[model samples]
Target: MKVGIAGLGTMGRVHAEAYRRMGANLVAVYDANPDRLAGFAAEFDVEAAASYELLLRQVDVVDVCTPTFTHLEMAETAFALGVDVILEKPLALTVEQGEQIIRAAREAGRRLFVAMVVRFFPQYRRAAELVRAGELGRVSVVRLKRVGFLPAAGWFRDPEKSGGMPVDLMIHDLDYARWLLGEPVSVMARRSPALSGQALEHVQALLAFPGGEMALVEGGWAYPPGYFRTGFDIAGDKGLIEWSSDQPEPLRTLFPKDEPPPALGLPMAGLEEDPYELELRHALAALESGGPFEVTPEDALAALKLALAVRESAASGRVVEVA
Candidate 1:
């Protein structure tokens, strides 16, 4: 299958490399800036499209790697041109825009897969398995923390393109929390008051779920000077499962053993595959089989809904009901 990559940013480049590594055809790439796609084109033997229209005409699948603000246009254009889409996280700048993209895809009978890459991470997969299998036993509380150095000050600091850390970064953990626990009925969040004359920096969200499961997600640019870290700890009646995204082992406690944890295959890769390569393989497999990718537009919508609810809660200082 021919895949066209749009937006030759860091993620675009990473995904393009992944597609190439998976042996999928990277037929064309489109980026508004020629310089952005230059290195990626050189690294991977894919032709860079001077315009998005050219890229859409050249490939059957388009990965919308641009920022959230631009997703709707590319997604609509691609679907209109009979090209399926692989949209980056936080599908669009706003829920209304994301909803419109989903609507267009359904009307066009096109598939839209959101790149919530963490779902494909082996550690997260295993954690989900444990939760589903009841090995964790009656999940009580889930706390996901993503605290690290912020991305370079660009659209990231701006609430328009990047959508702040709540939508840009924390949306992952928020979605995972919703997936692990049931859908949140309401959320309350507190932000660290707009800092440095910029957008809000740190955010803490409390989610109330059915079946007595509650989750707390904290995401921010607040990290100790120098290092970066992201991890989640889940607690249940039977035991607790902790996977530090950067650590070498799975942290677990069964209340009977004090031994060191088991070695968990790196989450960056799959059980026996690199995560990015696995993403490529899955996308290819799904496309060939005429099936939906692992992450559906609904899943992306859920993540976005949760993220927006958190933002509303933070901004209004009241519990915002999630739909």
Candidate 2:
């Protein structure tokens, strides 16, 4: 498949490498930053498109790895040009923009796949499988967290640009939670207060789903420099499954000793496969087979809606109902 990536930042570089590893034809790339774009183009040995339009024209699909605010423009342009899109999550800055992207893709007959990479994480994927198979029978509660050092004075720190920690970071777990527990009916959230100049930001959201399922998703840009950690604990009537990045052996299960251990593959224990690669591979395979994306455009929109609800609740200090 012919692919192009916009934005030469961390995720853009990651996607480019994954495509290279998959032997995809990396046709071209475009970025607003000339120096970064030139360096990336040279490193990947791909053409540097002079404009986003050129990038879309040169590839069968484009990876819209740009910032949240730019997703609509990039994605709509790709759809208008009859190119499929691999959009990085959170799909768009708002639910309306997300719906527009999905609508445009449907009108243009192009596939729109949201790159919710957390779903492809070995541990996360395994956890979902176990939950779906009733191993975690009737999951009642889930706790998810991701905390990392705050970026200094950038679009990431700007709520208007990157949607802050809630939308940018917490959306991963929020989406994962929705995948595990289904759509949430309401959300209540709290944000750390009185931190000036975006020094530190943290948010905790409690989501309520049908059948008494609940998820507590905590995200922060308050960690020390170079520190990052993520993990989740899923609890149900039968038992619990958990994993943490800080753990030496990552995944853990607590259940009766007599029960046979789950048959998770080698990658689950070691994280041998990069989640980004796995995600892109799944997208490409589904595209080729005319199958469905694991994280559909609608699913991405739901996740974005849920994340926005969390933001609304945090800002207003009231529980917000998700429509």
Candidate 3:
């Protein structure tokens, strides 16, 4: 498929590299900043479109790697032209806009794949699979932590542009939690207030699911510069699974005494290829084969719903029900 990228920032370059690695046709790229667009096009040896409209006309698929606020407008334009879209996470700054994007895709009859890259990570993927296979029978508790240094991009610090930490950074685990435990019934959360000229905010959320399943999710940009970490601990009736980025092993599984442990081949280290690359390749293949995507538009919407509820709960100091 001929793909064109919008926004020549970090994610835009990442997607371009992935397409190149897969030997796919990356026809063109566009960015609001002309200098960045030119540099990226030169580096990738692709045409630099003068504007988003021109780029849209040149490719069969448009990858919207722009900021969270720009997603809906770019996606709507692509769908209007019968072009498929690969959108980055948070889908949109608001649930209403996310719904609009979904509606546009349905009307245009084009596939909309949202890049929730955490799902493609080996450890997280294995955990979800084992949960589905009942290796971790009747999961009772899940604790997830994703904290990192502030983004270099100033836009990320702006609540209007990126939906701040709760929506942008936290949504990954929120989505993954929903993927593991099913839809949450309610959410209660607490967040540090954004201080004057502060770029960091921390949030801790509790999600309640049916069958007494609970998830404690924490995400933020509160760490010191150049530091990032992610980890998860999941417990069930039969066994336990855990992993931490700070640890040497990527995954660990334990079973109770007298219970025969299942034979599972888990990756002790990270994959050779970037998870973003794997995610984009999967989207492209699904687009080509007319197969269902791993991260569906509806799944993205559900994740967004949960994230927004968490934001509300934190702000109001009350539990918010997920509709």
Best by TM-score: 3
- Cα-lDDT of candidate 1: 0.82
Runs in model 2 deviating more than 4 A are 258-270
| TM-scores, all models, native as reference | 0.92, 0.95, 0.97
For 1-323, candidate 2 gives per-residue lDDT tens digits of 78899988888989999998988788899999999989999999999999999888888888889888999998888999999999988898888888999999999999999999999998898888888878866799999999998876488877888887888889999999999988999999998883776647788999999788899999998988999999999998777998999887757878767776555432444467789989999998888799988898899999889888998999999999999
lDDT of 1 by residue, 1-323 (tens): 78899988888878877886777888988888878677677778778787999989998899888888888888999999999988889898788998999999999988888888878777777888777877666898999988776676478877878877889989999989977886888899998876677554788999998676789999888765566677888888767778776877744434336544334322533365567777667877887898767778888888998898888888898989887
Clashes of 3: 0
Better of 1 and 2 by TM-score: 2
Greater-lDDT candidate between 1 and 3: 3
lDDT of 3 at 176: 92
lDDT of each: 0.82, 0.88, 0.91
Best by lDDT: 3
Higher-scoring candidate on TM-score, 1 or 3:
3
Model 3: ten consecutive residues of lowest lDDT: 264-273
Give me the runs in candidate 1 sitting further than 4 Å from their true place: 224-226, 250-272
List residue ranges in candidate 3 displaced over 4 A: 267-270
